[model samples]
Target chain A: MSTVNLIYFSWVRERIGKGEETLELPADVVTIGDLLAHLKTLGAEYESALEHQNVIRAAINQEHVDHGDPIAGAREIALFPPMTGG
Target chain B: MTAPITVRVQRDDFDLAAEVAALTCGRADIGAIVSFSGLCRDEAGALNALELEHYPGMADAEISRICHEAVERFGLQAATAIHRFGRIEPGKNIVLVVTASPHRQAAFDGANFIMDFLKTAAPFWKKEHRADGSAGEWVSAKDADDAARDRWTLES
Candidate 1:
């Protein structure tokens, strides 16, 4: 199992009840979509946080990426809602 | 156009006049400068403040990238973007973008372009704090903001 550091922001952070965590990803979790799916299975908080998968934005290594992006070598992954910054 | 880009993400406020001056100091080639500042609003007296959350490493990096792109696209001499993260009260500053160029239009366009992209690209979010002590909600991202960013791709 590969380890991944996951970070959360905004409502996602609140719902998940933490700012960040380290997880052991099953081999089947190859992409961000897979990660989200696996996270939902972890608990109700994650499920509630990622209820709307479409609106959930992810960044690998601090760069914006899509759900289809691979997680092979990602040191960190951030999940959050659409940015409202200006 | 390859000048240094200044990007700051802090909890403290910034001085717009000082920022502008810092960019233009001893710059004989720059002819025009445009500055834009975004302030928090009370939303008809309902807001006590706005709690801003940001991705620590990514916020400044993303804005620097956006500023670099704006500098390249608009031929800007310099660009600086500052975004504050923390609880901000009504009439307090939230963001500042200043762009300098050889001409007025480039400076204006550069500043405009930075703000349009910054709103959608920066890794920051706002949560409202109501004055009446009610629980606040995260501010939803606006469709208009996405449209604003997309329009720039069409322009250039």
Candidate 2:
């Protein structure tokens, strides 16, 4: 299994209090849902910050993706908001 | 010509005239240069300024991409943007965009296009410093900002 880079931005960064981290996930675990579930165990902060699932947006390898997408063989996973850039 | 465009995120204040001169840099073929400066206003009866936070690397890259896209989509000559984060004084520049083109309309439209998209797309968090010496952070997204962004889509 390859290592996955997890990143949180904006409010997510504030809530997580860390910018980026690398983790090795179980082979069976894929998809953003699985990642969120795994992250929930990190602490109370993750649980509260991620309480509402829909508001959070995500991207795989810098391109935005929906929650249902699988993370198998993913290298970088970034969680952010509805992208407010111009 | 090799550089896609210039996009910068900084904490210190910027000099508008100097930056513009650098970009134009003896390019007399550039007929029009459009610029937009967003200021920290005292609109809400507040004494202090606003503090902004962003996703660092992502913010600049996204904004740069937007500028490049706008240039290609709208036929612009060149575009540049500078967004300042952290504590900004009232009446200081929050964001600035300059677009150059052979025609005035393209330059103007390109600058406006970038602002419209940036307001809604740039992943920046704003927290205002109040007169009471406290701070109030803006909630997730604003409807007006979304409306501005939607106009570009409608045009296409």
Candidate 3:
């Protein structure tokens, strides 16, 4: 079991009711996709924030990564909705 | 022989003319400079301001990466992008992109490329603040923005 820091932004943060947290990932949580699925089982807030995992994007260590990307040795991970800047 | 590239994410507003002058001043090699400034629009007089949020470390890195790509792809001498976070009043500048090149077309296209990618790739989000003392919802990603960015990929 390894701990990973999770950061949420924008609506994802609002739905989760917190901006950041640290959680111990189960051994099975080896990839970003695995982490997302595992997170959905945590609670109502996790489920609500991650209900549309398809639209939500993830960044590992501040760099954007696909869901299939490995989570090994990652210190920081952020989840948020699509960007709307310009 | 590329000039310096600057990328900044701040809560403070930027001075357009000053920023442009800084890039072109004392540089005879730069013959053309194009700049684009994105302002906060009221949109039907209902919006008072736009509140921008960003992933601090990621915003800088992503914008810098895109600006670098624009400079290389467009053969630009220099490129700069500034994005403002926090509440920006209507008509105030929210983002700025400036590109300097030896020719007019490169300068123009470089600025456009930076703006297109910044719209969809940067880790920034905007929420409208309505004039009626009500907070508006966050703006969703537009398909048009993705299409705009995708066009570049197809072109390459």
Candidate 4:
């Protein structure tokens, strides 16, 4: 098990009630999808924040990645909705 | 010479003329410049302002990546992108993209390419501030924007 920093943005952060947190990952949490699943078990806030798994976008070290991507040695991971900037 | 790409994410508003002048003031090779400014609209008077939220480091990095790609793909001489965060009122500028190229078409295409990609890839979000003193809502991401961005990938 290892610790990693996780960040939430926009409504994800609003519902999670915090912008970031440090969590100790279980050995089974090998991918981003697994992490999201694990987070949902922690509390209702996490459950609400990640209610829709498909639309939740993830970024490993600030670059976008698929949910199935491995989170082996990432220092930070940010999750948010689809971007709306121009 | 390689194209110069400038990507800035800040809270301050930028001047259109100054940015263009900085990139093309003394250049003889560049003959065309295209600048696009994205502004905040009042939503037919339902909104007072827009609050832009962004991931600090990633916002700048993602936009820079998009600008660089646009410059290379269109053979632009220079590309500059500036995105503002925090509360922006109606009619104020929120984002700017300027591209310079020897030919008019490249400059236009380069600016358009940067905007299309930035809208979907950049780590920024907008929230509406109501004028009637009610709660504001986070603006939903539009599927139309995703469709717009996808056209570029299909072309290349």
Each candidate's lDDT (Cα)?
0.93, 0.78, 0.93, 0.93
B39-153 in candidate 1: lDDT tens per residue? 9998999999999999999998999999989988888899889999999999999999998888899999899999998999899999999989989999999999999999998
Which residue pairs in candidate 1 collide? none
Q: At residue A13, give the lDDT of candidate 4.
A: 96
**What is residue B87's positional error in candidate 1, in angstroms?**
0.7
Worst 10 residues of 2 chain A by lDDT: A77-86
True interface contacts reproduced, per candidate: 0.96, 0.42, 0.88, 0.83
Task: Give one digit per residue, the lDDT tens place, for model 1 in A1-86.
Answer: 99989999999999999999999999999999999999999999999999999999999999999999899999999999999987
DockQ for every prediction shown: 0.95, 0.43, 0.91, 0.89
Interface RMSD of 3: 0.6
* Candidate 3 per-residue C-alpha lDDT over B1-156 given as tens digits, one digit per residue, 9 for 90 to 100: 757999999999899999999888788898898999999998989998898999999999999999999988988999989999999999899999999998899999899999999998899999988899876899989999999889989998
Per-residue CA lDDT of candidate 4, range B1-156, in tens? 889888999999999999999998778988899999999998899999999999989999999899988988999999999999999999999999999988899999999989989999999989889999899998988888889889988988
Give the alpha carbon lDDT tens digit for every residue of A1-86 in model 3: 99999999999999989999999999989899999899999899989999998998999999999999999989999999999998
Of 2 and 3, the candidate ranking higher by DockQ: 3
Off by over 4 Å in 3: none
Interface RMS deviation of candidate 1: 0.4
| Off by more than 4 A, model 2 | A82-86, B1-4
Q: How many steric overlaps does candidate 1 have?
A: 0
> Against the hidden reference, what TM-scores do the models get?
0.98, 0.84, 0.98, 0.99
lDDT of 4 at A40: 98
